[model samples]
Target: MSNSSKAVVSFIVGAAVGVAVGYFLNSDKKDELVEKLKDQKNRLKEKWNKRKDQLQDELENEFA
Candidate 1:
């Protein structure tokens, strides 16, 4: 597609995302949603840290 077409598509997608985020932020359940997102964030961080540690240990063993 042309550059102009791509730009238009990107703009539309961005606007849609902005609207959705605005709706969620304005909703009554916003606090609940935020709490759930925070919990999910924590879970992902823990998982990532665990995986990183495992990889580090494997690399150390390989080098040793």
Candidate 2:
């Protein structure tokens, strides 16, 4: 009922859904799929880092 509890529940639900999707998507070509997923994960991480840096710069500009 509390905000923290709601957030935790949401995270658990989302993780479960993600796991189910991944499991269903896996196949005989697991090696290829794994490589593709690794590349996608790296790309996502790069994008996230860039966004984080940009947000930090913006916050500094606004607050400093």
Candidate 3:
């Protein structure tokens, strides 16, 4: 497999391990974990939207 494929497999394995560990370790704090994850997802989405808009503007400027 290519380097990128290997990287993707490694990431998937790591994420699985992380989720399993988190689930086992925080059996009593599920609600808190869910809230934190939701907040993090919202922040990441906002950042991605801003970055996408910036890139779109740059592309339009370059071609206009």
Candidate closest to the true structure, highest TM-score:
1
Global CA lDDT computed for model 1: 0.99
lDDT of 2 by residue, 1-64 (tens): 9999999999999999999778757867778877999999999999999999999999999999
Give candidates' CA RMSD values in order. Answer: 1.2, 7.5, 6.6
**How does each model score on lDDT?**
0.99, 0.92, 0.94
Q: Model 2, residue 7: displacement in angstroms?
A: 24
TM-score (C-alpha) between model 2 and the true structure? 0.56
- Candidate 2 regions with alpha-carbon error over 4 angstroms: 1-28
Tens-place lDDT per residue, model 1, 10-43, is 9999999999999999999899999999999999
Model 3 TM-score relative to the real fold: 0.60
Candidate with the greatest lDDT versus the true structure: 1
lDDT of 1 at 34: 100
By summed lDDT, the worst window of 10 consecutive residues in model 1 runs over 21-30
Candidate 3 local lDDT, residue 55: 100
The parts of candidate 1 lying over 4 Å away from their true place are: none
